[model samples]
Target: MMPAEDLDAEYPEDDWLSLSGIQHFSFCKRQWALIHVEQLWDENYLTAAGHIEHQRVDDYSESELRGDVLSIRGMRVFSRHLGITGICDVVEFHRSSRGISIQGREGLWEVFPIEYKHGTAKTIDADRLQLCAEAMCLEEMMVCSIPEAALFYHKTRRREVVELDDSLRDTVRADFQQMHQLLSRGSTPSAKPSKACDACSLRNLCLPELMNKKSVSNYIEMRLHEFVTDD
Candidate 1:
């Protein structure tokens, strides 16, 4: 395993990956590479709606203190060990008997990161893994133990708590390693069509049907012929 401090020396600052892409990469490697690697993106209803929701959360001007809890919005976070950087929607520092002390603050405070999502909780752990990644970054930056975090879903308007367990942390680290390897190779993997493709914004550009066909070359040739004949 690569040590945390050695990451900056190993990887250049320009090569740092976006922490949000972990969820995309976890969903589909091809999608991740298409967006982050090839720089292709198309916003469908879901993604556009998601952007709007995130904008609302990010537009808050200043941190607010609600009694013992200090709610900080749009908190920037990065982990050199993971080679990823991104912003959290909100991170609430709650006063606790056994917690880390903040500068100029009288009481000890426990950090709790909250991720805002446009959709409801999924059966899979994609959202959970993303939240776990954020929590890991927080732990690395603050040098404290963050045992859990929360995910706020727009559809449900509720927060789902996620425990930062060993297994989840292991998964986050392993996924980031895989992402680094994929980015280094700079080769987008072939499309693997599934029911999930229907929901993907890049389905049209990916051309799953044509790519999955037995004769991809023939399909391209036929399309070219049609274009030429039409002109």
Candidate 2:
């Protein structure tokens, strides 16, 4: 059997990384490493709104719901031992009735983690990966088996359930490794311009304009050469 330490090693944290790194890793590895590892940050209206939303989620105290379910809001959880840490928006515990039997064995309650987002559903799987990272943190901290989690989008006004399968686990592990590798190497990824770049709060600092200008200039130079050669 693989040692638990090996599993825990996959999640490593230093002053260079944050609980937010999980979200960053999902959005863009280069962007992720830049802000967290390189300390480059620029805030815009959208990011400001997201910051407020996270603050609201992380400010509440622990509580229970419906008497039978225990709920923890804005729970600050981190396992340095596991090398991962993040604030969970809400963790709902569903307690099975005492003496309840399943398959001739006593059954216990389960944990279901729900993360709230201020945006609509994204085309990328970053949101799902973020939720999965939270579940991994929960499993490590609480020593419980959390097979799945859910993402609640304010724009969609709905919840999307995500399974914590091997694929996601592998993604989380690989991302953590890649982030650490970039930080240790002190390397930042090159800018990748996309329509999504327009929406990023760091667009200005990231210099999408400069990059686009360079791209256009290069294209013009190439076209001029081609036209002159055709004469």
Candidate 3:
């Protein structure tokens, strides 16, 4: 087992962010800042569809019992240490012979975190990173080490195993800390135009076109002012 401090030091800049926040941060930092920091929200068709899907999952009354294990649905989790909160699509808890222990590390408690994605698998790592963060939160809250997690894509009807390794954990941690720092500073960074911008919910409000205009304006100002002379 790796030491916690050593694990933390391995990623000197990694700060844990909430599992849900990962997707937001990846989608668009400005969107994340406007929503999470400024507490703004608007419903579009995409968001509406997503809300319907999440509402189904958030309805935790769908747990099933088979033999000694119970499959829970739509469980919520939060970490004050990480300074973020989010909900898990599902959490499976098995009936363990060993009881929960504080100091005792040896026990049989199984925890499986399954995150439900509304669409097909993405080309980005954000989805998997979010799931990994969820696993880390579960480990911290349950006092057990979760070695792995899963992401269930509704479109693909499949699950992908997510190893709660140091790299991903460090990423989540880093993003969380960075987000806090951003919020504390009370200023949004310049728009970083990416292909993901096409699907962002706040594209209109963010107006990358306008930001690009400012960039051009600054460039032109610098070039034009370079030859200016005072009389």
Candidate 2, residues 87-134, lDDT tens digits: the string is: 788887776753122232234557788888888878887888778878
TM-score, cand. 3 vs. native = 0.80
User: Over the stretch 1-231, how does candidate 3's per-residue lDDT look in tens digits?
Assistant: 334563443212233344587788866778888776777777677778778887888777887767755677887776655665678888776557652443333445478788888778788778887888777777767777677888888778898887778788777777777787887787677788777777777877777767656577788888778867431
CA lDDT, every model vs. true structure: 0.88, 0.73, 0.72
> Higher-TM-score candidate among 1 and 2?
1
TM-score of each: 0.88, 0.79, 0.80
Q: What is the lDDT of residue 136 in candidate 1?
A: 88
Judging by TM-score against the true structure, name the best candidate.
Answer: 1
Give the runs in model 1 whose Cα sits over 4 Å from its true position.
Answer: 1-10, 60-62, 216-231
Ranking by TM-score: 1, 3, 2
List, in order, the clash count of every candidate structure: 0, 0, 5
Better of 1 and 2 by lDDT: 1
Using lDDT as the measure, what is the rank order of every candidate, best first?
Answer: 1, 2, 3
> Which is the better candidate, 1 or 3, if ranked by lDDT?
1
Per-residue lDDT tens digits for candidate 1, residues 19-83, read 99998988888999999888899989999999998888875587799999999899899988788
Native-vs-model 2 lDDT?
0.73
